[model samples]
Target: MIKNKLIILSLIGLSFISCNLKNGKIENIRKGELNPTVELIKVEEKKFILDSNTAPQPQYTQLYQDSSYKRKFTFLNTYTNSIYIYDYETAEYIREISYDKEGPNGIQRPMGYLIKNLDSIYIFDQLTNSLILSNDDGKVKNKISLIGDKDPKNTEWSLSYPQYYPLTVAPLIETTQELLFTGMYAWAIPDSLLEKFHFTSRIDLSSSKVSFGHGYPATLYGSEFNWDDPIYTAVYSDLHPDGNKLIYSFPVSHDLYLANLDSSLYKTFYGGSNFAGTISSLEEKKSSPSHAEMGVHIAGTDLYGGIKYDKYRKVYYRFLRNAMSDVSKDSNWKEKPLSVIIMDKDFNYLGETNIGTLKNYNWENSFVSKEGLNIEYLHENDINEVYLSLHIFVPEEI
Candidate 1:
């Protein structure tokens, strides 16, 4: 069984030619760049009612679609130690998966979770530094310590997604033989050493052996910018709909990266935003800036956000936070002009759709559905509302 898995990894490096659609026909242009063309999309709005006492935010929600086209998502309600499941289209309240806090099945402060299905759920426990697998009934099936005998002085790691630093994260990637998740580390180390750190860890399900690879792009080394800030180093990733490749990007660069599941080999493609201005840099600085100072600098900088793949349209979408102008130094981190860059399957730039500002919608919490891209709408005035609103963008040709 392991031999078959190794074979799949070896084939990932094989190159293939791709074609693009032009004038309603497929044409091969693999030798050079195709003429750049931008496409537009229309927006539609809808709402889903949530009768539960707890109001779930988009940052923590995970949307999953079944074979029958039923869209259901789950989010952890920490207050109740339960995971709430809801129907995406119909706004129906589904059942909740409740967990214990003390017994053998007890969970120790779960920071993030993944639901491959009702029967296969994975939870990352912060207290134990472990990953736990559970079922719909919340019965613990298996558990593995992520920090087994690792020296913290040399390296620190975590799977928990900080609530404050919201990133569109996939808690774990599950295959027939392995499970994978992007790892985060502390920034206390020197810039030279930190730049070489690996950002992914893979665990063999059959053997429970953990290994790390998939280092950051070479462009990250010796850069003028200070990547110590989480905002710059944070990654937004999505798995290809075919489940063979993992596509990810950093907030500091416009490059989109593809990491093969079987090998350390990877590839990169240009995916810069049309509206993104120059990203701010901290050059020739003798000391690190305060957190507030860093936040203020990043506020006026053009940075990228989460990346999503729309299987329905056979394209990808990435969030672009446009640079703010004439901003006050005292101004806290707030909403700014935002847009979504569309890319074809081959990472070709399609077009960008401006979606107003972050105040109106939550791009961090979004999913690609049959209707279009559903982004959560923020209701500032009615904080006690019992429903979740969304803005759906439908792609259209110009």
Candidate 2:
């Protein structure tokens, strides 16, 4: 009787699987009507190559150019929570600053930036929720806490609110004497209220003040899904060369929005439909007969992003991973190739490039610097043993 019952259960499971296979069909979710084929223009060989072993595991690097277009300095963020300053003209590591000790908060994840005046360096500590200002000698001069209880509705008043998560910082852009920086306040709200969610603020370096700013409400669009559940998301913004416009990406809607401090016009580009399949019904259909969400999975589920405006090409270099295409029945999930997409400033589709077959690979962060396009991915020669690898891609032409 037991054997018969087991057979019956096995048959029922197979029947359910077959039914789901028929109903849950995979669909392609990438955006843009124009599927323009982008041909890789091989202009020149790799002119500069920095092996990972030689330098500190480079998390981020920025190339500073003088008014004459000559490279001045290369500021590097090292894995050791220290900022390494290299004089490009001298081709040497001139100084290193350690912000980990002096501040009230610990410096676990340090994102470094050289201020416009070229005198001070700002390090954003992802672990401590604070910003550390230092000099060329690595001495901490000032510290700013990004988190506070100040309510935007009551800007004049201040309160005490407990910070739950660490802060992520962006590079500071200058206008005249004042410097500007952007960051997000990580918090949770009801799914129904996600659309009204604007958990970010702007900081003025001179006054040492932070002002709450508005952000794209992604929860309004994906109301049916669980927006509260932490999925992959990032908030990234860049200042135009002239500092007139700030271009930023909000992953929830998979859209790029432009904000002009001068005009106060905050508009989203491409109607927030640049990338395909940011939202999926797979989680909702887990018990359903059809696994429709399977189609949206490309390779990685995270919304890892690196965006830059290419003046020469007149295009925006935006890179992110697609959903995992292959789902494994085995307990272990394996790595696959990543899809890199390039688009115009207006979010028009240019073309897609596939970085073929990377093993034990996980992407952390990416950025566009004066040196070229740099991406940091967790990679392993053997499956299971993974380490961070920083890859730099230079444009074919000089």
Candidate 3:
């Protein structure tokens, strides 16, 4: 089984060619010979050395904020084995809580978040197929299991592709005390399974429970058609500043969907084209697909998204993009271009600006501050070389 997984990873790496720019020149942009000035700001990097042997691989990190704009806490997921909490200001590991007392072994990628006002954290464990509750101190308090009687006709019943199994949990958000979560399931499963087990979006905490709506049915071919399922990939949701609406990213279709607290009305923003990229077909290999292409192909790419509201400009900062393309051969990749984009609250077109474009440039993570400041991590080719870039956009004198 491990060997098979390794092969899959290798194939994914070889699937596409690098998309880096050539001769260090970005497409559609002019090359300047002037001495370019780039600012370097330093952020304190405190280490939280964990028991590497015992710690599950860290898969994701989320920063939480209080209503007053103070840093609350940062949550880390160890791929379903355990959830760790760290102090944002001190950078110290606070606690580690495992969903299953026995700990995570395989197929469990637990993802979660810290709800505001609540002294507890909510986690979604994909391996054990359960929802876990933990106190602020990282102690396990309760859990909700997702696994039930399986039907042979159910797409989830077939263990052929466990990755598609509705086991990977998305981050958890809070609406008061009620917690909300989104899960993905393959479409090939039986209709009965879809009705009973396939859940695209839901809100459940202690007493309150609500469902956004049923997901589209899965296809039987178990091939490309199955990719059409709305819940095939990672689904992300964040609470609006108003606290009444939730913004979700439907990765499969590469569309951003907004759902009200009532889950009564849902709409797509930016006409769906605002978040997608163009892909061109490259020459085919003797055995590879002819239509195969490379170089930052955005169509059907995975995306990371977030929103920040600004009262001064009466606009919202919506950040969206997919993983950076491996541009090893292209000069553009060497001098990575900043693809960060900002959009209005209503999805109106504002303008495009490069966050940072310099030699040995690589972006790791980004977040918008309540004061409308954008903070991003720029890393060198080396894993340890990282810098925090603060981008403050002050409007011109009126």
Which candidate ranks first by lDDT, i.e. highest?
1
* lDDT per residue (tens digit) for residues 1-398 in model 2: 01333223223312111111112221223444545556323221121223342342344555566456656444454444555445554455555555554344345566556544344666665445556676655566776766653342443321222222211113555566545555442323334334333434456778767655444333222323332222333456666656667777644444456666643335544422233444443354443222233323323343434456666566666545444554643312234445455666565666655554334222334445445454554444423322334455443321
Off by over 4 Å in 3: 1-58, 65-70, 77-109, 115-119, 136-138, 147-170, 185-199, 208-233, 251-255, 261-265, 271-314, 320-338, 356-366, 371-378, 381-398
Scored by Cα lDDT, where does model 2 land? 0.45
In model 2, the Cα lDDT at residue 268 comes to 48
Query: Against the correct fold, how does model 2 do in TM-score?
Result: 0.65
Clashes of 3: 10
Q: TM-scores of the models, in the given order?
A: 0.81, 0.65, 0.56
Off by over 4 Å in 1: 1-46, 66-69, 149-171, 186-196, 221-224, 284-286
Clashes of each: 0, 12, 10
What RMSD does each model have against the real structure? 8.1, 12.1, 11.4
Best by TM-score: 1
User: What is the per-residue lDDT of model 1 for residues 214-266, given as tens digits with 9 covering 90 to 100?
Assistant: 65543342333345666666666677777877887767665666887664665
Return the candidate ranking by lDDT, descending: 1, 2, 3
CA lDDT of every candidate: 0.65, 0.45, 0.41
